[model samples]
Target: MVQSQTHTFEGKTIDEAIEEAKRALNAEMDEIDIRVIDHGNQKRFPFGRSRAKIAVSLTESNDETWETWLDNEIEDQDLFDIPLSPDEKQPVNTAGTAWIIDGQLHFHQTAEKKPILVIPYDGEVYNHNEKLSGRHVLKENDVIDFHLETTLIETKWTVKVNDKEQTVTLTVTPGKKIIPYIADHPAASVIEPIVQFDEQVNNQLQTKDVYEQLANMEVIEGIDDAAIHRACSAGEEQTVTIASGKLPKDGKNGEMAFRIDIQERSLPYKEKHDGTADFRESLYIPSVEHGEVLAEVIDPLPGEDGISVFGDVLQAKDGKPVIIKAGSGIEIDEEQSAVIAAQSGRPLIEQSGLLFRMSILPKKRHPGDLSIKHGNIRFIGDVEITGDVNEGMTVEAEGNVQMQKNVMHSTIQSRQNILIHGNAIVSAITAGQNQAVYDALQDIVPISSPRTDLLSP
Candidate 1:
């Protein structure tokens, strides 16, 4: 039996009319054969509606009375192509995006450009399947319906189901099809089905429902869905940090890290005769010996590593090394990291870059008393005191000390011998007490001449 179906359409030309029928019937050029029945006249005056008629029928029989079924299909297609009434035969579908109309959330890099949607499906984020050119808002679990105009793609497929052949209509979409495909109407853009890349979501992305953008084949390619899933699960500023390069730390000049304790050891001001406190004088004199270590350098630290958001590695600046120059009567030991005195003398660190050395004081005769006028003495070499050491004063020497007058109510310390021609008197101060008594006298005599260490001036 021959199976055939007929339909008609009006356009500016016969081809345009036929093309409209093809779209209405949803048929490709090769799928059906057409015989022109009539070419309707155009308006002899101005632009008037043109009309035409054609008979369409299948060409071959792929299966057998499926041929009759094909005839029935043709008749069904012809009925579907015609509207419910003749006046409404021509139906128009305006092309654009469909899903954006009912969307709950929307996003874009800039506020002016078209925004992508983050749709929630089964507790995860997805993008708009439609290639949205403008703004659209979508929310989680919003029921979206893809109309035929928005979702239909030009595609055809067949599958062997139950060991028998069955025609399966395919829509152009992103999914697990594993086949070459285009849409039912390939030119008509489609809204993608939302996809969930992660179970958890990032806070920044979550606030905007942007866990994942529905991947569209036309706009974007090679989307790492798994990577997007991992990013979403990271849930915040958990993205990779760019590696920061290390800077070279400038070397610090070596110096003594230890404190020169002067406050605790210095003498406090006290009252003199008439039980009145002078409240004026306090003294300190620091002394040192030969081969003594005064200062050391600290260990250098290593540089830290840096990283980038894209997972690139960066280097950090390392701490630089420092060297301390030892001056006269001083030695530098690299292994010990120390500046040591070569000989016994007053420990002196010079003004030049924290270098350490020793200084030997010179013997001098003074006309006046060794009181506040001379201040406190810190001599590294042999010292001579011609006048009496007045009350509340300190004289420290690394070498032997020789005095012409007695030391009264003063302190005198020497690394070597002490020679005093007169008495070395010591005194005590008692708070709220009546009397001021002198302690034992200190006197020293040397057995041999001493060696002196001095820095060259």
Candidate 2:
């Protein structure tokens, strides 16, 4: 006889625990037998903070059988699969036993310690000064006393399951107390339990009661019985959207429609290559040509009505209308659906009027480098500069910027690439694409570091 190795491990799930055991023991499926101690459950999604346990031990595959298999005499019948895992979660809730939680009352007794007490939520009892089983609500100045002692204790459970039945018993030591019906708790199947678990769970829900809360309740065909059964078995407290009143679905609001290809200029950060974060593409000035339709205001949609759970009719609010009429070089379409371009210019859409309006402005020009003479140029069209953009100058253009001289120590923004004949030095230049900008500064070295920030690069 050979002594077999044994070990126990825990994981977020049973499969995980088994895999951990396999890794620790370095054994194959045929070489080990796994006994699941506890099939743990999660309280919610993505991940629930709970654990499961499993026991693993080397199988009793004797030496003689192994020798026969090693001689190439093994057949497909030699392999087998084992299945002993829970299909879904089955929690054992402890909510019903408390009846009431986190409440206090005035005690008339002079004793220094008060016994742990639990009472029903709806039921009532007489409130006497000495009795702990009364129905009186507690408030401030309530007489209470207790000697605090913190002791760590282990919880134990014994589970027995069969094709038709599943039973769970919780045991507490030091006090030697055992409570059966772990599957019978009111909160057991908080999510959904399999139909096989129906016989095991206690405190099942009543569907008729839940249906009463919803107005114009429609019977969800096919899976209704199974869903309700599973929900009841799980003892879930979360509001069942299927069985509740449905609120109105508000209509889609009217919007100024535009294409993403034309509006993807202002980037949050520059993408990285090897290890550097390029910040070049922060400047986005949306521009439009003389004959281009920069924006179109779509029509508002009507809302859909909803029914309350209590059979009340809920009103649906309609989407508000927006007006895009005001602006030079831009005019409303014949159908009044869109704001069309009258002449070439950049459209400035804003919500200044009761609804919304867009204004189009003409081209801009900076005679010399940006200075106090220019005073922060913010143009909605193409821009041209005759001289270098000197220190502390800020220029923003909705269209392309054509610079004749080097840009230095300033903020230059453009929706399209800013074509510069001279070097770009010590300035934050934001543009749609930086590849052209990189090519423009291919040989230009920094005159001084000057804390320059090149965005949307």
Candidate 3:
């Protein structure tokens, strides 16, 4: 959208001078995007030989954009548009007659014989007096003068000299008021002067509350509670504190709005240390928390190792083995055999073998197998399936549980071991550890198993 602007310059015509101003303003059009729309005649000397001095107001695309555009225009012209021409010749009628010392009539007086009338001259005002008065009697020194005056008749109509129509009042008598005229002209207002005290007061007020808070609060090594509180209260202005040096005023919402210079603290030790016997530095250290260590060994000894080991054993907790170790050629009495046989009841396994045992049975008896029907499911622990698990079902067990049939769209988890007996089909299966449980089911199949039943005729 094109914007309007007023540019004033003295030239022979309004258009010529206005075009010159526009050219000067548009010289740097590539730098600042400014487009002039139209020019307005602010104060025009229509009947003047004074080079038609005018305040040409024109419109631009944007007002703010015009400032830089005007700057560029001034730089390009190397001068303001203020005209440097001689004074203009006023209109004949409105141009007052010279004094009698110069033998001029006091036409400004209402009683002059041939008065040169000035009826608030705005532009060229013409007078039409068709009925002319014949030559009047005059002496060698008769004052032949005229004065421009306005007379109100019956408070209804007004008569003003120098207007084109001599009989009645014309609508164009008040061509344009001078107040608005001057306002529209270029350089109408002076540039404002800067007040340094006002700027300083504003800066002080901006940081007054923050400084007050900083002064009131306790000072600590790493915590600036007062500064933080002040910053929080300040909302948008915040301050930051350095660890071992003065607090920096560069933080957001605390103190300074932008960046501020701050000296960083030196390192604990200097690069080149002076050889002094009494030289010592106190360093601030943070407290560290102690944590348990977890280490893994291939063949661990009994007393010498942190974790005890047993063959065919899984874990030991509280000085008791969850799974017993069985070695080759080791004979067991009747009582020991019964105990061992009773412990080897069922093995619980996990879905992913990385977690729990895989392909091994547990020595202790466990709860019976649990089965689920169709639906999407997730299990937290191990699960045992006695019968066929339908599609889209999940089974979870804390301990190992065996399955009889194939599971579909489900998961099984176990802490110990998992054993499968019958054929498992049409499902996803996961195991925990490498040898946590045993899978005796020979017909175990993945979801990608071949569809032999579909191919049959």
Candidate 4:
């Protein structure tokens, strides 16, 4: 038979003794279930020791499993719902604020207060919905009435209850209405009319009434001398004083009723003539020897009336008066004057043909000696090499390639034609393979493949 394990500790009260037993068993309050089997008589106990008997029920298991279960129970008991005061608990208002005609809702809140509202309407409403069904203009004495329903939730315990939802209905009747005046069918001011007039003096000269009477008038009878004299006498008195140079003062005496006729005068004609001179075969006559002859004709030939002569004067074959030079030469007639001029040298005439020929070739120096290298060299024109090149060098030219030395492990390409005048070794030739080469050669003479040999050792 197994002996029952009984443990007891004395304290002033049952709670104190049960705490002592819990400490002895190394069990927390949540891990064990305590049952009081006997509350010992307080009379029989001593002054400081009150007798209490109890049994603690706990799971019998390994220390690790027991500790794990005890830790989970402690953690679950630690969480609790904190209580809120009456002032801190309030309701959320769901009805939105009011709005004026052609106006929007504006909200103002203090630091301790929050304004949140929800609106219920007849249609499906989404966030940021705008309503434009009301009248834009408000008239005087107009009433705008709306109802606001605010829901408030007041709690009795820490746990929230849905049945305690309360609503407060608010009816807002806006104050005295003032209507804004909007202009409709506005009137525009009329522009003033402008008047114009034309007159010779202060009186209107071209009057319609006077023109109508003159339109019917005809030249039926000529004016008499007495009538003309009478009309001239009635006019303003005027005196005519003629200038001495403008009018002829030495006119015939007793001449009356003078008449003047004006005519345009014609100008005198002037003619210019260019004298012809030939110096192709004329011998050089010094200026000192022919000083007088030069001086007489130095003014250059005048208008079309003058004539010029050059070179030796000889008779024509027909025996007419003539002059002859090495080339065709002629003289003027006896009525006109002819001038003979002498020149010192023959005139120069420019020849009209090609002047010079030139040829261009690739530079024939090493890259180290020159500013540029000839690796994968391409020429727009002919390529003539006068120096040596290292192995794995390439040359592409449009016209021809005339190399004085050997080209090894290189390439040569041309579009128009190619002529190599040196030995080539281990080189590849790719030309006229595709339409791309022909297309690239339209403006640029030749398109050459890249020289992979340049990267070779």
State TM-scores per candidate: 0.31, 0.31, 0.16, 0.16
* Model 4 bad stretches (over 4 Å): 1-372, 430-436, 440-457
Model 1, which residues run further than 4 Å from truth? 1-256, 259-281, 310-312, 350-457
Cα lDDT, model 2, residue 339: 57
Minimal lDDT window, size 10, model 2: 189-198
Candidate number with the higher lDDT (2 or 4): 2
Q: Which has the greatest lDDT?
A: 2
Show model 3 residue runs off by greater than 4 Å. 1-201, 205-212, 223-457
- Superposed model 2: Cα runs more than 4 Å off: 1-242, 259-286, 351-355, 365-457
- CA shift of 72, model 1, Å: 54
Q: 420-451 in candidate 1: lDDT tens per residue?
A: 78887883212111122111111111112222
Task: Quantify all predictions' global Cα lDDT against the true fold.
Answer: 0.43, 0.49, 0.30, 0.31
The predicted structure with the larger TM-score, 2 or 4, is: 2
lDDT of 3 by residue, 373-442 (tens): 1222122223444565554444433346577655544555444566767655655565555233223121
lDDT of 4 by residue, 1-457 (tens): 1223556555556787779878887877765566676676657437744467777655343545543554465358732122345775732221121122221222222223323322323222122333323222222222322222222322111111111111111111112222222111111111111122222111111223222322333211211234223222322222221101111122121101101111111223223245433211121111111111111111122122111111112221211121212111112122423222232111111111211111112222122211013234543334556554345555554444555666566666655444445666776655444354435434432122211111100
Task: Summing lDDT over every window of 10 consecutive residues in candidate 4, give the lowest-scoring window.
Answer: 255-264
Q: Name the 10 consecutive residues with the lowest summed lDDT in model 1.
A: 437-446
> For residue 164, what is the lDDT in candidate 1?
17
